[model samples]
Target: MPVVIPAAELGEFVTALLNTKIPDPDHARTVSDVLLWAARRGVDSHGVARVPRYLELLDSGEANATPELSFSGGPSGVTVLDADRAPGPIALTAAADEAVRRAQAVGIGAVGVRRTVHTGAIGYYTSRIASQGLVGIAFVAGMPNMSYPGVTGAAVATSPLSIAVPTAGSSPVLLDMATAGIALGKIAQYRNAGKTLPEGVAATADGTPTTDPALAKMPLPLGGAKGAGMSLVFELITSVLVGAPIVSSFHSDDPQGRVHRQNALILALDPAAFGDPAAFTEHVSETLAALQGLPSTGEIRYPGQNSAAIASKRAAEGIPVGPKVWGELEVAAEKLGVAVPVTPGG
Candidate 1:
């Protein structure tokens, strides 16, 4: 049976396990916080289940436990961050902070990050910027794992983007999505639970569409060509612009070309830079209220509306961990000599 663990306890366990691998407390804390943020919001695909895989990355030296991040080009509201293969959460969080700082100084701030590991839930970083009353936008380009419309095999990254706009008297309005019809994480989750995937979402290694989770090797683009085009544009803007192309490198013949890496672009726009920040948030709230009042067959929810509600409920009721993920966490705890949290009635 699955278990429900308190948010605080889960966070502590994840942090402890991560600390055993990552020497820097701040980096570990950022990663744990982002993962928990996703879980609390009911985005289980990018949640704590990723811990075991992240540990593997750290263990294999694919992710630098302690990264020496470098920054350049602060003038003109633009910056580039070289993460030195730091875990995504650590590098993206730092990029968001830098973007916010620059936005506060000028009207806008943009930061491009290069050579980071899997960026878990890009919305977490954008939401951080929204918390400060600024509009946030982020895009990530990574290795090829999604099929393009005309390509046979995996031909493009399931690149993701997120936008967050602060609102008055409520949670921020957020939109987080990937170019693929379904994320690769979702396929892994389905396979772990022995569930079949919906047709057209995924394909086998040979590009044959498959509903069997075990055989599904890659996700298809969201709207086929539209999604593939977006993924390509994202790669050009983020990876190519940053001088670290991932998709191209992954398909290259270079011995080390297939090494896992990702690049991202984070931008922050201060409401105060254009008009009164308070008025802007108030208007945003009004717009959401109008959207909620619209006629619908079911509950009308904006992008992040349901997620905020889920987070509140999980905070009080505890987050649910599937049996498979719980077992994995238990194994990691034992390996690290860290105490696992006892789930209620477990």
Candidate 2:
């Protein structure tokens, strides 16, 4: 069974739980905000269900609870951020803000982040940039757990990319995707729901494709070689460029090579730098409208269209939490001495 929780209450609960590990209230709130943003938009795979795993990371010293983040190489529009193993939301949010600031001044901004942990939903950072009326692009590279085509086993990370463009209407045009055919989070979600994995999307420990969620160990690349190549390129531009180099390090014999860490690149482009900013947004809205007006048997939606609708619906009706995730939250809250939010009728 699932429980329904008000978005506000869930956010507060998650924040409190996170604060137990990360004493900084602001950092905790940032992580909770990003997670809740995904949940409200119906991306439950990247939502609050991840809190338990994050707690494990913080507890095991895999992620720094309070990192001393620093920035360098920023005389121009490009900058490098050393996160000191900070949690993903904190590092990426700071990078997004810096990108926006630089873009406002120089028409374009690019920030490379190093030594961060799992970046949940890269779209959050891009959407943050888009909210400032700037076009945003972001990429994340992490430890490899996805399969490469014709490879014997897992060979690439399911690195994600996101782009967001401001529109005249409320929701921005957002595209958030991983290079893998399916995300590990989605596989976990299916396993929790007792559902089978989609055929050809995931593989077993031996790199053989499997439709059973429980048997799936890794996600296959999205378009065979195409996705694996994109993931490799993302790693090169983000991790290698940032001097983190997660892929090569993970495959090396260095004792600490397998340490979990991620890197990211965030870029922001100001439309005013090109032409009339207002006209650009208006044209984007017109383009979306034109696409939606096309004849079809079903609704024609752009990338962020259904997400906006789902956010509105979830905002009013409350977010649904599965039994497994709720139980994990309960255990964490109890351990942290935080009170769990009550469901309407649990």
Give one digit per residue, the lDDT tens place, for model 1 in 229-313.
Answer: 9999999999999999888778889776789999999999999999999999999999999988999899888889899999999
Estimate, for each residue in 1-346, the C-alpha lDDT of model 2 and write its tens digit.
Answer: 7899999999999999999999899999999999999999999999999999999999999989999999997567899999999999999999999999999999999999999999898999999999999999999999999988777888889999999999997699999999999999999999988998878899998899999999999999998999999999999999999888888888889777889999999999999999999999999999999988998999888988789899999999999989899999999899899999977754
Clashing pairs in 1: none
User: Where does the lowest 10-residue lDDT sum fall in candidate 1?
Assistant: 248-257
Model 2, global lDDT: 0.93
Q: After superposition, how far is residue 245 of candidate 1 from its true place, in Å?
A: 1.1
Question: Residue-pair clashes per candidate, as listed?
Answer: 0, 0
C-alpha lDDT (0 to 100) for residue 135 of candidate 2: 99
State TM-scores per candidate. Answer: 0.98, 0.98
